[model samples]
Target chain A: MQRMADYISVDDGLVDCEVYSAAVYERELESVFGRSWLFLGHEGQLVRRGDYVTTWMGETPVIVLRSMDDVVRAYLNTCATRQVTLLPYDAGHAEVIVCPAHRLGHDTTGSPVSGQAVEPGHECLVPVARVETYGKLIFGCLSDDSPTLRESLGDATWYLDNYLLRENIGGLQLVPGVQRYTMPGNWKLLAENFAGDDYHVAITHASVLAVRAQGIEPRLNNSPGKGVGANLSVATGFQTGVPHGFLEVRIGEEFFEHDLMRAQSIGPEAAEWVRTRRDAVDQNLPDLAVKPYSFHVANLFPTLSIIGNGTSMEAVGLLVWHPRGPHQTSVTQLCLVDAGAPPALQRQMVWALTHQQSAAGVFAPDDHENFERLAENTRTFEARRVPFNYEMGLSGEGVDVRPPEWQDPRWPGLVLPRFTEMIQRDFYRYWRSLMDR
Target chain B: MVDMELTAAATAFLNEEAALLDDHLLDGWLGLLCNDVRYVMPSTAIMPAEAADARERRNALRWGSFGDDDRDMHFWLYDEDYSSLNMRVRRLDTGMAHAELPESMTNHVVSNVIAGQDPLDSELIRVRSKFMVHVVRHENNENTFVGSRWDKLRRTDDGLRLAWRYIELAHPVLPRTISIFF
Candidate 1:
């Protein structure tokens, strides 16, 4: 079996194809997913007592629920007795979970509640080691020794607050149902893409951008530094020591310029909402507000990815790339909007997410195709012999450094130019470190 | 009672529409829709069958569902109006919608058609049918989508034009990208 060093060389910025092999994948399920904090679902999904949503922590199915005490908790979804699934539904309100096999019942706390006396530990659902919430988003970890969720998130929270906990506007609320679909690829590929792969945007989504460009007026295009090409010149990617990373495109004055164009196309209300939200941000997170950057794509460690497009206030999507096997990933996508936003604005937000991020959307399908092809190509022995390149912005690699004036003293973590693979390299370095233990 | 003539007409219209999509003649397919066409496919979820009555009762008061598609407040796979639908077609025409660049060969099978004249409107018919869309892309990448569809067809000088459509895909988790229409 290949060692972690053989699979990934952070210094050389080369990744062996064997990183996606079954052996490596199995180890990742343990070292990476098992010990790390994994996103379950948002608190908005659990509005009332007994409300629960079923999701996966790695491959283990877990139920995240609001208990009778109004505290949020999670437990393995499998029945203690027969090992059958406790709840088969995606989400529902249940006072007591009854195992379909043999009429055993479990209370909201996952303790067996059937009339028959049960063994204390043998008949209770296994609880996850720790459950924590950052803003409204909930995460669970299987290892008791793992760092707290806040520590795992590290400096990434500074950027996430701009979107997750917007000022005065109550936190984000997910649209009713999740858009779940399967894509052919290793889960890491999708996570890395969101981490800091803005380079692919100009090429991978050329067709969608073309269609959008035709719809926008030429006047809107006058905003200096409007598109990806211009934004890349000022884009910044951050690598938190915890391995979490995000890419931010600071399109200075063009921050809310799209709203002006949208106002003409979609009534004045569009521009009004942007103004109100901008005021809230300015009043609350003055530091983040001052930074003239709105577009953000971040992968919080393993599978959770958050994307916020401040230009289109309604375009926020929370994605989970759940690993299915060595070659397949199941994605659960949720559209999030400010809970305090008007119904019309919320609807528009959902529309934006459905139009661009969902499986059938104009943008995601193209990315899915590329991921599927990558999975296929890397499956063969001959293909596995070749190494994938990740040296685009390696230090001293002749890549232009961001101008000194562009750097923000307030931003934490190792910030690099937008067109760099530093985040991906650091992400793999952290993964390799964890596996080495 | 089922209107046999209306059922035949609706079946023929649906079959022809499917044929146009299968042939990748998206523009021809677009021509069969009314000016204010609403083509929608709502995401589905799995729930306990025993909770059906409680869920339905709750759905009556609130216009959304956590375990099923709620037209008003839930997420949808596709919630396109005429303009959006037209834009999607235009996107494919660009020859760069990579998901369909080497477009898939599709076979749309429409069955179990049931149609009846709308009681309130003389020139409108409500129709329901089951559909199985089999698609094969690249070499061996195959995906089959099975679902039921509800449509409101309006009588026009040209023939029956689809005014509204609601699709309920059976799978709770879709197997692949829905690059092709249902």
Candidate 2:
């Protein structure tokens, strides 16, 4: 490797096409994303028995809907001839999914309803592979050999359940749709950024956090965003900090003051939601050492990440890693929410979840400006070391999360100074692993 | 008063408006509107068939005809005053509104104008046109924008001053940002 002093080069590209020629993105499309149990959607998406929504698994388009039998299903959304775009809209419910091109159609359960144009032989939106549902969570694949969704998640399901899934939990609902934002950088840059990088708050998101109000009438200096203002309680010290992938920050008590009981929808039942969310955050979250648990962001590799505490619906972001060229990547995120709720509650969740997390979100955008500038401007003519240092929490305190997400279970969260460089390091580490696969 | 001449004037008025938009002259674009003019884009929902029928009767399609295109909350040269428009212009100048950036360049190709008389005055005119817009930014490639536009023109010696403008964008998901004037 070159010295850290040298700047980044196109040669420092994300994919080493030569070394990993066999494990190309094409292979990833056919293998990784196709069979990795990509999240298709949640149960709330279809409030009615026969409603449906559609999404993608890598490049494979899939439809998800609640069948007339009340079962949620996932199926290859492509036409039998593979000549259709499926449903283009991000999310919508249809009694039956119809294709305009081949006149192919299917019921919510992936069964042929009509439009095949073929005889009674082969028909419908060809059931490409496995379709699985974990409560409201739905996933699909295009490969018959793909493992079940539970197998793909591996031991990580424990983390998912402990952190998410709760009773009266609103069933981990995805808000009606999502707030979309695109990040221009290396696709890995964003994936790793969300995977774990709490050290960035001191600089990248300093202003946004400095101005964040505790769900109250945040007193901006008579201005929307001035560093210091009347309403902001500035004197308190933040948390110490944690290692890579683990983050914690303090949130004030003056939060979760929603008058949902007066909302008339859940009304008295709203207390169950409050308890479920608060309990989940308090029990499951680990310390980030420096950043406190009051605020936290945890990402479970490759694509999915959540930004949340207990009460607030953490933005569940799905990354669309689109390679722009040899190095440029456009990472698009669709923040999820509970779709079963009424529109009034759903809207608030979308912005708050993403407003705190998306690439353009107050915090994420600041980080974006930094990474984009880093990636776009670093394509120099000469070789230079663009070493991203994660030495801060190394040994002195809050180093790296041991083993990192279920890959190894016994690792501890501490590193020597300039300690954990998990994301960038593991990215290359996994890159090599996939190449050999 | 509402003749082909009025149609000619409305075209020029729209042309100037487009020029201002291209030039990042937001206040100038808002200046050519009537205060009571409405500017709204209603939400699109695929409700049940029963509600869908009622919505059609209410013209609840993307832009509620009366609420968004005809409501009194719309701004113009007189009502918003220069300050309100200036504030809007400032909003564009600042890095606040992520929806659209003043830096984005645009082209509005307006044609197929349909003109009629204003009910309040025979001397006034209401004109509608179908437009195809093309926008380009440094980072993104050119994107086509399809929308229909309506304008109420009150003749001034300078030609015709705009009284109202209602733009109905055909593609609601919008390529990027729809910040410029149409």
Candidate 3:
């Protein structure tokens, strides 16, 4: 069988189609997902004792809950006796999870409640190796040796903190009800897209950009220019050795100015709130603040992806691309708003997110279509011989190292010009490193 | 006994709306909506019976606690007002909406129609119906969406028009992109 080295060449910027093969996919489940810190859900979801949300760590279903002790915990959502799934629901308040197969009950902390005769540790719900939280976001890792959540996040936190720990605005609170859907593609496809594929945005989302340019839906409009080249030039990509990647478009004070001008329409209080928040950001991270009101898409390696706009009106959507197989991916998207914002502003942010990024949203379909086609194309024998090119910025045309003037001491990553595949290349390099282990 | 005439009229209106959608005559479909139209599709969840009941109780207590009556904290596939709906139709008209560039051939089946006079408004009729939409795009790319809709139809000057529609898709996890309106 071809090894990880055969499937990807980071230096060559070429990825073999066989990377999507079943063998590679199965290996990644253990090598990459098993060892990586995967995002589970936000702490905001499990506010009260007994509150629980069911999600997948890779393909393994786990239940994240606030136990009776008020400590957040996660356990394999399966009965130890027959390995039957204990909880079938997406989320709920459950004091004890009972297996439908045999009526065996387990407490929220994965302790057996009904099984008395079974051997100790044999009949209890299996617990994940580690469950940790970065701010309000909860993450789980299957391997005990995996780095701490903060360590795994690395310099990526510099960007994440901009939203996850924004100033003046309260911490992020996940909106209820995750938007779950299945996509026809390998999980990596979606991950890489969010990692840094700003180039595709102008072309893939041309229609939406065109419509937004006309200013028909002013609240949802983020496009600054009509031409594809003009739109592509505004954003830049950032990558870290931690394998995290993100794209950002710097909108500068234009966003605050727009918010102030349209204050009467969005309501004066909400407008004033925006002004205060922007000022807080400027005070906190003066260098990074200029880029606050921009579109951002980032992937915290392996699965979790975030698409957020820094504007008060736009929401940050956290997406998990759970691998279903070599070809299928199950996506769970949760919308988040600043907890400090007024209820009305939060609602508008949610609405704006729903309008642009949800299942039926204007932008997601085109990306899904492309991913589906890529999945199909890469499955054939002929396609396996042809390597997918990732060499766009390799020759240094239209790509530049982070200029000294643009550097912020706080932001620590290999920041590159927008229209390059360097971020995707770094993503594969890290994936290859994991697969090599 | 069911009001057969009202049911027939409601069914006809739904069928007409379905026809316009299936035909990709989005503009014509938009014409069927009242100026204050509210089209919504809430994301569904699978929960234990007891857990669902508990959530309902919690929601009941928390309903008006937020000051604003915005109980729509849950994510939705769509929560469109008339203006947003108009913009959606206008998006498709742009011919660059690649998801539907090679527009999907759709068949919208509307059934289980039940209509009654609204308790609060004599000029409005509350209607409940089931819908199965089969969509085939790019030959092999196909998906079927089956759901139920609770709609409020008002007797407007332009005839009975959809004022509010709440869609509940049966699938907790949607199969694929929902490019077409239900």
Candidate 4:
């Protein structure tokens, strides 16, 4: 069973280790996701003890809670006897999390506070499989074998420091409110697409192209920001593997470039402001050789992906659901970075995103219909030989920029190949090694 | 606590305004409003009790006519002329070209029609009306939005214009950008 011969073939898809395959979506009671060091909420999100927010940790639904001591904690989402989630309310601070149906009561730390109809102690925020954080991003795991959140992120922390963390960067915060939508497709497809894909921009996001044409997209795009050099343009090519062209943090009149530096050198304050944060981030992303890009649209693995436009105004999260066995996927986009940015920046981000590719954007309707039909087409036959063309940058991009681990090279763009036959090749390489053992 | 004739007039006036929005008739809607029609859609924010008391339940987040000329750039609406209104209407047809699906299909229902009996201004009627608006939009899917509107109306020789209107939402954070007027 440890061999993982039964389910995954990263070459086919992420080779599902039998351990994980058995749990892909096993029932809530049995799934290991609930037990893994799942993502709860960010530390910045819960500043006070009573503050609490609910999040699903794989199959183990749970909540990251806060209490009187001002320390944050985790609690089981399930009621004592009933199967329903206990703290269903959106977000609020409170002394106790009580499930009305089961009458199970526990304090924020998930310990028995009181009020369980039982003869005695059944209260406690069932301990998480694990809990940890990198900068502001928090993770909770339910399984014993899965590594700590830091390890779970493995090497992604380096990319995060620039976007988050205050030490050397602009203060980062998530503007509240979620944007959501449902599409019909496999959840994994969306993740791969977000992880790294610049080929789709000209084709799929034609509407965004139109927006850029209309003078909305500030950074010059359709090509690599710096063409191929940070010396030529460090702050220039701060590219994110946007499904479309590139994600450049557009503040006003355009200042910083993709490499997280000023396009033109700056005053002591602005220069220090830009370089320190950029250096901190570069230190984290060990693979980039030098400054890796600052555009932080990340795949929190599994299903969630977010990208910070890195501009004060631009930040959004896409929570995509592509349930297996179903021919559809749900893509929810929440503009979570607007916790009171400057009025102008807010207007620009709101205008550019909402007006272009969002659910109602000119481009979304097209993409939605395309993805829907594509999913339906896949169902027509088994092993239909669905060919994804990741060949766009492949012609010249194959050279190893970083070698052994990656080929990003002096290349100006594309984070890494996340999916596709090529990415599948990378996946199988990793999965096969794991299974071979 | 107002008179009936003025109430009837205000109701008709509000209905006319809705027709304009429903029809995407930006010009007609603007023409019907006061030149100084204070159009501001301020999102509600949760604040500390002390802050709330200082403002007397009134805030910049609260949309109204500006009601004050010194602070009012009230003349901009008409000063722009029908060309501006045309631009707005065309922008809507552009389907949120200015804001992309920014405007939801809101059913602005103004009721509880009340008009003042005492005439303060020559032709102006102190009218108050209660309103409820429902907006539905299809983003990745379908979203239903609901809210209430408070309007203070003043009658003109031609018709009633919204001197001020305040929208209070049951949900403070709007789902997304609402480009269309309610």
Best by TM-score: 3
Q: In terms of TM-score, how similar is model 2 to the real structure?
A: 0.62
lDDT of 2: 0.47
Which number leads on DockQ? 3
Higher-ranked by TM-score: 2 or 3: 3
Instruction: Give the range where candidate 2 chain B is weakest over 10 consecutive residues by summed lDDT.
Output: B70-79
Task: Estimate, for each residue in A1-437, the C-alpha lDDT of model 3 and write its tens digit.
Answer: 55688789877889998888888999999999899999999988898999999999899999999999888888888766777888888998999887898787877777778845578768658888899988878999999986788888877676666645563467777787779998889988889888867888878988887788778888786433332321112212223346776676444556566656654476878887777767766666775622445446778887888876546677889999999999999999999887777777878888888989888999898888787777878888999889989988787633445556656656556656667888788788788878886
TM-score of chain A for the candidates in order shown? 0.91, 0.66, 0.92, 0.69
DockQ of each: 0.59, 0.12, 0.75, 0.10
Residues A1-437, candidate 4, lDDT per residue (tens digit)? 23444444433433332222223334322332333344566665677778876655543456776667766666677775666677665466678777777566776666666664454445434666566666655666666774556554543443344454443433454444433445545554565455444345455655445544454334312223322432110111121211121233221213344322322222334444345544555565556544433453445444556654444333444443324433444443444433333333333344444433454444455555455545544444343343333343333333322335434543333343322233323323332333344
**Which candidate tops lDDT?**
3
Could you give the CAPRI-style class of model 3?
medium
TM for chain B in all models?
A: 0.88, 0.67, 0.89, 0.64
Better by DockQ, candidate 3 or 2:
3
Fnat per candidate = 0.68, 0.00, 0.80, 0.00
User: How do these models rank on TM-score, best leading?
Assistant: 3, 1, 4, 2
Q: State the DockQ, from 0 to 1, for candidate 4.
A: 0.10
**Candidate order by DockQ, highest to lowest?**
3, 1, 2, 4
Scanning candidate 4 chain A in windows of ten residues, the lowest lDDT window is: A231-240
Worst 10 contiguous positions by lDDT, candidate 1 chain A: A216-225
User: What is the C-alpha lDDT profile of model 2 across A1-437, one tens digit per residue?
Assistant: 22211222112323222222222445555434654556666666678887766655655566677778887776666666765767766566677778888667777666677753566647756664666766556666566774566655544454455434543345454433333334445555665565545556555644444344221212111112222211110000011111123233233333333322323343433444444455555544453322111324444444555555333333354444444432444443454543334444343344354344543234554554565445544445231233344343223222332223323322122221111334334434443443344
Candidate 1 chain B has its poorest 10 consecutive residues by lDDT at B61-70
